[model samples]
Target: MGLERVIPVAEKLGVTRPEAKVLTVAGTNGKGSTTTTLAAILAAQGYQVGLYQSPHIYRFNERVKINGIEVDDQVLVEAFVRVDQARRDCQLSLSFFEATSLAAFLIFQQQQCDVWVLEVGLGGRLDVVNVIDPDVAVITNIGIDHVEWIGDTIEKIAFEKAGIIRPNIPVIFAGQQALPKAIQDKAQACQATLYAVNRDYFYQDADDGQHWNFASSGSTLRLPLGHLALDNIAAAIAAIQVSGLDVSEQALVTGIRNARLAGRFDVRQIAGKTVIFDAGHNPHGVEFLLKNLQKFMKNHDQYTEILSIFSMLGDKDINSVVKLLKGCILKWKIAELNVPRAASLAELNSALHTENNVEQFENIKAAFESALAEVKDNQIILVCGSFHTLEAIWECLEEWQ
Candidate 1:
């Protein structure tokens, strides 16, 4: 199917959208995390939840899951068949993203999901997923990404993300974005109950290293996840409370600790080194990941060297992302990601700034090999920059070991 076919078919399918409550997520970086967190929280509360995310690094089925299990391949294929046939009559074009978005929505309808957590694939206003009106809308930390499709300024982008907030819906944001008042006006126009971080709910890391304190208008609980995750956790908890699900603080803490969303700072063992992976596409996310990685490294002992395996698409703010991770990256093994929009080696080099300690590889596997050959025992080998880089290395690591 094509982008044109995505909407009409989705609109037709939505006419019979199954008996399911909806919680929509729209943002720049934290959409997947917040969606996964809410899915886990609701699943722990004994509700059958369906989650839909985008830009899967590993598999197409990663986009749709129920209670953390990827929807069966058979189910996905059949749903795709229906959507394909539906579009055949119209002969409409559908992008890869559009087709997958519609298929997943249809699958959610087929399954009797108690709650559906949907993340906008791109800008909220025109995104295929926006065809579904979400009950509880949550925007997590709006930042600059998709500048061309959305807008140039943060306020313009926020306006688009804020489009998901429907009338009378209580929209819980992770924090007040550094955007113009136009964004606030748009949310007010939609009649969404805006609750920014530190306003409707507040979080403070306790002086003790054990736990962090999270307080909302409804309730407060000391969370198990660290500060980096509190914003996401708090957003999930706030949305759950607004949903009136009666999920307990114990469930929140347990779910937060147990929540393991892949491709988000996923750490694994490879060739006796700390193989860290994060799919931080844009600069904002890269900044956050670098900050967390530094803190994590500082808190740990016996780290020898930092080797980075990096690649990115042509579209991203590659320079900023690379610069953020470059200072401490003792060595760089640049490679090509197996993706259509991959940035060439020359483009990747622009981010390196200094010419020293950099090497080029045919692909991510080659880069990983180079890094592995040189790294010390127990040293960190971070495979980051883009999902394509991490995804390629992730697949290769299975065969390497």
Candidate 2:
């Protein structure tokens, strides 16, 4: 929860100050998307980009990447060895996350990347990724997810997220909602140039659905739509425009089109039926998922019914998520996740007590398999609630393949 332990170790490893241009992203939601887009755009512009994201969906190697390629196991082993030696020399014990993050930093430093796009693992102030000073800071949005670790209120969370802002750097508040006072205050205190979405820059879905428009003070780009959210992509563009990088319009276009992350409205076909794998565990994330779901339903009107293979962590606001999704999901196929933080079956039952058509399973695989067998031509299945939930289904799909 604090940087006291990791700072000395980072110093010992000689990665305290990054040689590459750094963009550190902190927010409750959209951090992955923003970082992905940032890395893609930079790489598209021919820069050697190092992207470090947290809580990889399938593999630990997914956490550290250079130009969209995950580093090999040997590379990770070598980096971890170096990090372990550094920690032992400093006579400090690093948490699993702290140790892994320091290893990513070491890899990026050694690889001599032109740019580093770092995503804050948890709250921004003391998170391991905040060890490096960023050339540009990006706050995707302030939401209520990590209340126990951050704070109960939005302002408090915003304050923690604002910790990534450095003096005189360009900070982008890409939240669609009104700016949080904590963020405004922190930016002012640091004298950082703040760019709030819909204030200093804006993005809107094009009527054609194939393109979106981004407009700032002087530039407007009609970009091709990609799988990720527009707001996050817009934040990436805003960061690059102020990053002093030599990115052109073509790079921005190519990057937005290229950026893709697993479990983020990831639509695919399985068993001749459509399935959307989304890792939206919180209310804010679910709202975004619903918006995209609604768009998909509108375009493909034949898909009349929506079913879900769902479960969540016990710490999350499961009731709120169920309430948001209940209106659209016709049938809920749920199971208790096989994780330490998984919600209990009793808790899942209680949250979904009001639902009319609900089916409970012993595990995520059975629930997903049931949905696959029963889904009709005019129906679609949505696998969501937690990344662990998606991982369960992914294991099943991989075995079948």
Candidate 3:
């Protein structure tokens, strides 16, 4: 019954996908932001919500939250126990993501929650979380990531993320590309209603190309969502509207202003100089990071330096990552992460040697120190490319303190 038990219990329980009013989110990026935003809007509307996300920053409890508070460990343990008792011996080789997903499903079933925001782990269709039939399905910005399981091309990848769309449910999509077309095709095959940008609904950034837009029902607004952040906002808004959650234009405005998905271009100050931390590993996410950074820095026409600190899992394309970030970055802090999957310093060096301003380090702490030593106070330090990198930096900060 420990949190570790998940195999047979899940099978024994018969894949009991809850019949909750679910809002399942699947995409290459922005899943967290879109899910969290929907949960926040519902909570603001007084709905008891269960939000499940992935790859905890610090604690396992982060995957399950009720009303913005992570489920207590005791609750998690009890859910695991129930799953363990159900399985009893029918061994299912569940990954940690698979096990935790089942536990969350069971917990949501037991609770009287009004809505559940399910975050997809990998591909949408076969992901353990996909067992449930969602009421409102959302696909936010498709791209090429997780190739081993999801396939290679963006089209193949779209098929996987599109798996979140359930029959008869209303689906909202972003990322104006053929991927949305793939989702629409799947939705049509399932007889699901599809509303999308440039068709059913769309979003435009206000503040002269910086606000969000949701052009649904043939109307648009100067999306007052400022903070240099717009991650699947259009799709989220469309989903909310389709789900029959009545919120004024005011709530959307408020939520966008208040919503914050941690570790996605989140800005902070370690010792007064500006720093941005984003777990954007793949080329798609990197492209966005570079674009948004470039867009935001447009006013500072003066050559602003980029101090890029990075570490990543070995499976990721370190070379592609280097190529994507090469020109934009002013300097590089190539550090090795502690996790088993982390890319080695040697691998990073080989990837970046052809690029400019690149340096190697034993690990994250040293890289951070060296970057700090060389960068000017006005320059910005962007820590990115892996969640493990952020976790390591956080741990280092704790140790230093």
Candidate 4:
């Protein structure tokens, strides 16, 4: 639950500290994309990179990767053996996240990664990934999420997100909103150089909308857009530039073009239907998805109708998320997720509140199948609401393939 419990076991396993350059990223939404892009950039430059992320969409192996490839089962098994032995020696009970994070560190250490790109599993202060001090800490963005664990207010959440900043290390803030006072205070206390997105670095879509340009201080580069969010991609570039590493502009462009995460704005054509899978569970994340969807609609001929397969966790603000997308979503195919904290059909209906263009299914697979069966030409299907919703569809797609 706290560092006191996990740090001892990490030290016993020889992973309390890292020898590789560490870039720890923490945020409510863009952690996965940012970390993936960072790793791609570093790897493009020929550095052995280790990326550790959480809440894998398909397999547990997706949570750990070396040089853009998921670690093999034998690697994971070996790391787990060491972690289990260390935990037993320490006589401490580690949470699933803590134990897995230690295993990732062990793998990265044993592989002798040149750069370790880690995504904070939750709030930065007490999250298991914070056990290692980052050479350059990046806070992708902050929002009112995990209110129960972090805090109810934006300031409190930002405070927790800023916890990864160490004394005199460079800190990057890429949130859309203005800098929170909590982040300012923490940066000043740590004397970490702060780089706010708009003030210190900037990224803007080109007039053609095919490419984007990133500028920081006196240096600037035009790069091709990737499947991930351009803001997060730009932040990754900025983080690497500030890390004092030798990364060429060519490598930056290659990395951005190569960076792709499975669930974030993932678009595909299956059986001649356009389907988008986004893991935007909260209001802020949903807003980002809406923007991307609008752009997608603009690029293609306007669809006659937009159908959405949606479900969310019980703790999320379902009402707010549904409210945000109701205008664009012509019809809804709701499903009950199989997870413990999944929202029930009743909960989803109560949140809808008489919108009425809805059909309920027993599970996500059925809901997705129904959506696919009912699809007409020029109609788009959006599978979103939570990662679990997309995971079900992804598993189904894998099976079909």
At residue 54, give the lDDT of candidate 2.
84
Error of model 4, residue 274, in angstroms: 1.5
- Which ten-residue region of model 3 has the weakest summed lDDT? 1-10
lDDT per residue as tens, model 4, 1-401: 46999989988988867889999999999999999999998999999999999899999999999999999999999999899999999999988899899999999999999999999999999999999999999999989999999999999999999989999999999999989999999999999999999999999998877799899996988888888988899889889989988999888888888899998989998766789999999998999999999888888866757999999999999999999999988889998899999999999999998687999988888988888888888799999999999988888796444
Q: Which 10 consecutive residues of model 1 have the lowest summed lDDT?
A: 1-10
> Which candidate number maximizes lDDT?
2
- lDDT tens string, model 3, 78-133? 98877665655665455667668878877776777878888888878778777777
TM-score of 1: 0.94
For model 4, the stretches where C-alpha displacement exceeds 4 angstroms are: none
Which scores better on lDDT, 1 or 2?
2
Q: lDDT per residue, candidate 1, 184-224, as tens digits?
A: 78668888777778778888778876788878766667777
* Candidate 3 vs. true structure, TM-score: 0.90
Q: Write the per-residue lDDT of candidate 2 for residues 317-365, one digit (tens) a residue.
A: 9999999999988999989999999999899989999998899999999
Q: In model 2, where do residues sit more than 4 Å from their true spots?
A: none
- Screening candidate 4 with a backbone cut-off below 3 angstroms (N, C-alpha, C), the clashing residue pairs are none
Clashing pairs in 2: none
Quote model 4's TM-score.
0.98
